[model samples]
Target: MKQSEIIKRLSDKELKKQVFLSQGLLLIVGVGLSFIFFDTFADWNSIMGWKPKQILFYGVIPGLGIVLLDIFIMRIFPEKHYDDGGINKRIFKNQSIGFIFVLSSLVAISEELLFRGVLQSVFGYLIASILFAVVHFRYFTKPVLLLSIFSISFLIGYLFEVTNNLYVTIAFHFTVDFVLGLIIRFKL
Candidate 1:
């Protein structure tokens, strides 16, 4: 199928709601698995780079940089921005600052916990990144977007390895989502 047709189907309100529901579920699943299978969230705080400067360098800089790069790419090829993976544009626009914070926090925490925290622990970085990319199934319709997701996931995995802090990955993820979420909220 053409990318346009797939994006058209994905943009429907029902599909957007489904994605929202699934992301909500991701938090539960991640926490549940962490409790049931793993023993500790201890290593989640094992920050090799504990200094604020390091955190900014490793997490915030790359996080913001990638988001900016995405914006540039999306601007250049406007159609590439169609890959929302079912984020409800209307809900995004309607959300206030506090509410958008909560929503964006939820997204960052849930996905990072599962993919980087849980899965990366078990499967290692490369495999976990591949799984993470695969879970973003909508992007597959556009190979470039799929590649982008995989590459970002890999980078996040690398950051997690270096910092040994789940929060760093969460920060990166949060930065991207919250910024983009706000942009979508206002722009559209």
Candidate 2:
């Protein structure tokens, strides 16, 4: 389909719904892929040597650190780092902050599971992080943001490599998304 055709058929609300649903679908696909390849859900934690409780401490810690790095970059180049290239128009035009929060959590968890947990675990950090950055091609024009994304991807991947805990990475991803979602919602 042409860009114009897609734009015409998908209003902002419709696009948001599709994106939200697609993210959920990605989670299922990621898990399926993991199971098919590894055949051992139990090994998820063993990969990083992590426990459930470690997620609470390590996830948020790394997430918060990334957020601070984001803030620092965005503050210096607000237009470059903060702009979404009309993504907010497709999502949040009609939705409430609560809805955005829910979506953000879903996106974070799903993305972490797929990227850090599955892809990184299978392919290693360098390749997985590259794939993660490539997927966020929207940030390409904004060099600082693109670099930040790649860096964050590596950090999350590194955390997973060291801790071997999906929950920890999920926690980090969720925290970053939640706070950043709020900030963007409020334009803070």
Candidate 3:
């Protein structure tokens, strides 16, 4: 069966379940990899720094900027260019605001922890950014979506590199996913 046909066959509950399962796996892998790679808790703490200013500046501000740009693109471009087998809509459209927040937060934390915290820390920015984009394999057939994800990945990785804080990237990822998920939920 074609990909869209497969997507269409899956119920929203199943999609949400798969999403949760996948993110849970990512969280496990991220934590496991961190433990394997870091020599001590202090090493992990160094990268997982907590600072309000860094979160606000490096994360929230840039995330909002990317959302605005995405909104602009959605307005100008055809919907087909941004399609992802309707997965985002199926996962988010009927979800409650609280559920959206929770889902987005889970995704942001797990993905950032794995991609930026573990992969980028060990392999550097370029590889981590590329792997991040590649992991969103569904976007490969859509050039615009692929490029957008790649650019976003690169930006998030850069933020981690500059701030040397996983929290910064997590906040940024959360901002983007939360706001976008809200937009989807509300059909905005």
Candidate 4:
């Protein structure tokens, strides 16, 4: 079956359910790996480096900047270059603002926890970044989309490396997803 066909067959509720299940799984794996890799909970806590100021400066600012850039690109480029089989629109367009916020938050936290928090911490930036891009398999057939995901992954991984703060990455991830999800929801 074709990708578009598969996407067409999936209802919004089913897509949302899959997202929740996958993200929940990622959260479990992230937390479990952190426990296994770190000597204690304190070690995991230390790496989180949770600071409000840092999250604002390092995460939110950069995330919004990226979202703005993406919006600009979407305007300039043809829609086909950025299309993801309408998955994002389908998942978000009919949702309430609160639901979008919650869904985006879940995605950002779960993905960053697994990728940047655990994988990057255990392995390295390059491996984690590549894996991050690879896991977004829907983008593989579109060069522009694939490159964009890779670049975003690399940037997020680099942010974590420099700041040594999972919160920063989580905030950054959340900002991007939330703002873009809003755009999709409002058809902006």
TM-score of each: 0.81, 0.83, 0.97, 0.96
Alpha-carbon shift of residue 96 in model 2 (angstroms) = 3.4
- Report the error of model 3 at residue 132, Å: 0.5
Task: Extract clashing residue pairs from model 1.
Answer: none
Runs in model 4 lying further than 4 Å from the true structure: none
Per-residue lDDT of model 1, residues 1-188, tens digit only: 96446655764555557656888899899888878767665654443235676667877789899889887877787664545544446557766777668777888889999988888877799988888888887677776687789889899999988877777888888888888778777873
Compose the digit string of candidate 3's lDDT tens values, residues 1-188.
87677778888898899899999999999999999998899988898778999899999999999999999989998989988878999999988999999999999999999999899999999999999999898988888899899999999999998999999999999999999999998989
Which candidate do you rate higher for lDDT, 1 or 3?
3
Better of 1 and 2 by TM-score: 2
Most accurate candidate by TM-score? 3
Per-residue error for 181 in candidate 2, Å, reads 0.7
What are the clashing pairs of model 3? none
lDDT of 1 at 78: 62
Report the C-alpha lDDT of model 4 over 59-176, residue by residue, as the tens digit.
Answer: 9999999999999989998999999988998889968999989998999999999999899999999999999998898998887898889999999999999899999999999999
The C-alpha RMSD of each candidate to the native structure, in angstroms, is 3.6, 3.0, 1.0, 1.1
Going through the candidates in the order shown, the clash numbers are 0, 2, 0, 0
